[model samples]
Target: MKRKEYAWAYLFISAPIVGFLLFAFIPLSYSVYVSFTEYSGYQAPVFTGTNNYAKLALHDELFWKTLFNTFYSALSIPIGMVVALGIAMSLNQKVRGIRFFRTMFFLPTISSVIALTLLWKWIFNDSYGLLNYLLELIGIQGPAWLSSETWAMPAMIIQGVWAGLGINMVLYLAALQGVPKSFHEAAEIDGASGWQRFVKITIPCISPTTLYILITSTITALQDFPRFQIMTEGGPNYSTTTIVYYLFQNAFRYMSMGYASAMAWALGLLILAITLLNFWLSKRWVHYE
Candidate 1:
């Protein structure tokens, strides 16, 4: 009867587990297999061993360029997190209409990302746009934001931060509130100034939240592509061509399935390494108490 009960327990979770294996595991396994070959969706996959990887590592110029773009975009995550945390800390203080402001901050997080990107495209329009118009008010000429190669990635980064700030800010707000008020009071009694208290106590109390935000934000930024697709299409000389964007172009557009799979694996490995590094470093900074 005990064995039969265990069998029944497994039966309850079996369907979802089977679905995950079929939909996720099988595709992932197939992609890994395809990465070792030279298959263009239509042709029989020809095993190229490590030749594809060698090409990317030793010969592909675009590989490095895409990597740089990915890095460039990720820098915005830290900048956004810092700004959002500052805003959240202030908003967390006792104040009237705080709930309304929180909702306003979180509104962007719930909106459709596709719609937001389309709207930003117009906002960064070269000829006449809200951003350029605002710059004009200050007697400063705005460059073509999404069109200029030099400005395209920066424009996307800024838009990404603006759109995503609310979620991270709310997360920090929760962390801030979780901090025990007694600690702050004790520090004040000890003659600790505001800056010193925040640095020594508030930051330590919130370090775990910071680690979580850093890892998740870095992963999201590294994989960011949809905004790039809608805004720049990885163009203006491939300046915004992140690895994921290039993978999409190669897989769906050019039908270089094998090459695209290789790129995907490379990106996955890079993300894994970065995540591991973040975890390792968090040991020193991510306080639990």
Candidate 2:
């Protein structure tokens, strides 16, 4: 009977297993093979050993530039976290219409990404855009945000933070709710100030959630591409190009599939290293109760 049950369970799950092998595992394996060869999409792959990797390491200045842009854009992760946590704390108050306010805050997360990006693109337009118009009213002229090398990355970061705020706020709100009232009450009785209770009790209790957000946000930031594609198309001077955007360009535009594959693998290794580092560092501060 147990054997029959196990067979039935496997039978039910086999569809996904087959799909993974067909769609994900096969492509991943082929990409690894392709990374060692020179291939355009139309031609058979020509084996090139480590030449692609060597060129990336030694000759490609754009590789380093895009990598730098990727990490620089990740600055939004910590800024978003702090802003989202503050928003979550504000929404946690017990008041009428709080649920409605929460919904408003979270609406952007469920909205269409393409639509949001398009909207932001217009908002950052150099002339007659709402942002620059507001700046003009304050006696300050906004730069040509999406066109200026100095400001393009900052524009991307601002949009990224705004678009990501809803999801992060929701996650932090859930974590905030899970913290026990008794802990705060006890701390209050001990004459802990409001800020002390928050810093000492609330933050520790939510450390696991913080770690989760940090890891996910870092990965998302590193793989960012859509905004770069739509907002700047890698930019006036390649200023906003991220690693993933550069990879996309090589694979599709330049027809350097082998080099793109190598970049993909390098990015994967980077993500893995960072995630492992986050886990290693979490041992010191991520308290679970």
Highest lDDT model number: 2
Report lDDT (Cα) of residue 214, candidate 1: 92
Q: Residues 1-289, candidate 1, lDDT per residue (tens digit)?
A: 9999999999999999999999999999999999999998988999999887888899999989999989988878888998999999879978899999999999989999999899999999989889999999999999999889889989988998897799899999999999999999999999999999999999999999999999999899889989999989998999999999999998999898998999899999999999999999999988997
Instruction: Estimate the lDDT of model 2.
Output: 0.96
lDDT of candidates 1 onward, in order: 0.92, 0.96
Predictions: Cα RMSD each:
1.2, 1.2
lDDT of 2 by residue, 196-233 (tens): 99999999999999999999999999999988999999
List ranges where model 1 is wrong by over 4 Å.
1-4
